[model samples]
Target: MDRMSAQKRRESVIRAAIAEFARTGYHGTSTAAIAKRVGVTQPYLFRLFPDKKAIFVAALMRSMDDTRLAFERADDGMEGGGQALRAMTGAYAHLMSTCPETLLMQMQGYAAVAAAEAQGDDLIGEVVRAGWMRIWETVHLSLGADADETASFFACGMLGNTLTAIGLPASAGR
Candidate 1:
């Protein structure tokens, strides 16, 4: 088999890490599992990432970037706040249904933040908060910079995430 480049291996590790972390969370996931998923040895995974925390952070960042791009793409060439809002909403819904792992990884990121903060480790929280702000800003601008509208949109999105995490159908309370 052909050998993968370092960059490609790193990307594979990140993808595998996302799935593993989504399933087991930061505290529960082990580097061995991530390496196994990526078809690499644990030492090679470490060479790609300094430690498990690094791998988790990379996965979390990727998930956030993916989300931000989804909103941006959905709002591309759209006019009017309501129209952009609907487009972004549809994009998010598609992401939820098709890329459930991303959603799960995002939730796990939030949970990991709280866990890390309690132990006086704020790095994870910092990364998550910054990433979240990027998403918020993207939505805020796409929604015509209306603060109330942006808040309402995120409020609904968070609720949706919670519902999905709990295995509630999209039509559960409707």
Candidate 2:
């Protein structure tokens, strides 16, 4: 079998890690499981990532990048904040339905940051906070730079995520 490039292997590992972390969270996920998911051995996984924490961090960064790209694409060619807001919200809904694992991984990443900070590891928390701020700023800009509007949009978004995460039926909103 032909060997994958280092960069490709790292991407694959991050993808697999995202899914695994989504399912089991940071504390529950293991490098061996991520390696198995990637069709690589544990040592090979470590070679791609310095350690499990590194892999998780990579996954978090990938998730943030993917989300930002999605928003940018959705808002492209749209005029006015109302149109952009609608487009971005629709895009987020589509992402939740199709790539729910990524959102789940994001939630896991937040929890992991809190846990890490509790253990005197604030670096992950700082990175996670920065990623979140970027997302917020993206949404804020897309929604016309109104502080109240952006806050309202995110408040609704959090509610939507909570409803989905708790397995609420679609009819529950009725």
Candidate 3:
């Protein structure tokens, strides 16, 4: 992280925040811990981000963006069909196994956005939902623009994330 530009440092902080928040969720994680993970002072983190929620939002957006990329890469230059869906699902399964923290971050983002909306604060909800819609649209288009297919894919993905976050196997029964 040495000799990096301010923008680079900010990116590093976002990455650190993702790991920290993934483990502890939005309310449970602190800016200080994120700063420590980035090897910077908490005030420096504040310089990079306006506040804790801002950091959380950045991390949430990045996670969703990455997920979108996964689907895109899986289906790139291919016609929409069952094979593309299988490739995307396999890519997602690999992502879940390797980046479990990312899966946890997705779960946390949903809860945080819902809570903020319940309190009459829709800014975070809007930001998070925009990122979510990008991912949804990516999958929707990749799944041949079938609304039910898109919805079913996301539903299964959410269930997988829930089980992963709760430390349960995908196959919970024998």
Candidate 4:
């Protein structure tokens, strides 16, 4: 069997961290759990990431990047604000269905940020907010840079996230 390179091992660790963090928020998850999930020792995991917070930040950033990419892809070659908005919405819905873990990780990241902020720790919140801004900028530009439209789009998306987090089905009202 070929031994995994440090970079490959790091990638595996990030994937494992996402799953573990999605199931349990940052404060609830342990480095041991992430390492075990990645089939690595704690020391190896530490070598890749300085600590649990580092792992969580990586996973959160990755989730945000995935979301931004989906919107960008959906907007590609699409003309007009309405068309781009619809395409982006559909892409988000597809992402929510196909990669629920990403959404779950995002929710967990939000909770972690809130908790961190309440305790006077701004590191996590800073990182999460920056990642969120990237997604916001991607959507904002894709929707023609209309502030209201972008705000509305994100408002609806947050509502969707909230409903999903509460175990509500998309067809709940139908």
Work out the TM-score per prediction. Answer: 0.95, 0.93, 0.93, 0.92
lDDT of 4 at 47: 90
Q: Candidate 3, overall lDDT?
A: 0.87
- How well does candidate 4 match the true structure, expressed as C-alpha RMSD? 1.6
- lDDT score at residue 64, model 4, on the 0-100 scale: 82
lDDT of 2 at 20: 93
Alpha-carbon local distance difference test for all models: 0.90, 0.83, 0.87, 0.87
Query: Deviation in angstroms for 91 in model 4?
Result: 0.9
TM-score, structure 2 vs. true: 0.93
Per-residue lDDT, model 4, residue 140, is 93
Where does model 2 exceed 4 Å of error? 169-174
Best by TM-score: 1
List residue ranges in candidate 1 displaced over 4 A: none
Q: Across residues 22-125, which tens digit of lDDT does each residue of candidate 1 receive?
A: 88999899998998888889998888889889999999999999999999999999874999999999999898888878888999999999889999999999
Number of clashes in every candidate structure? 0, 0, 0, 0
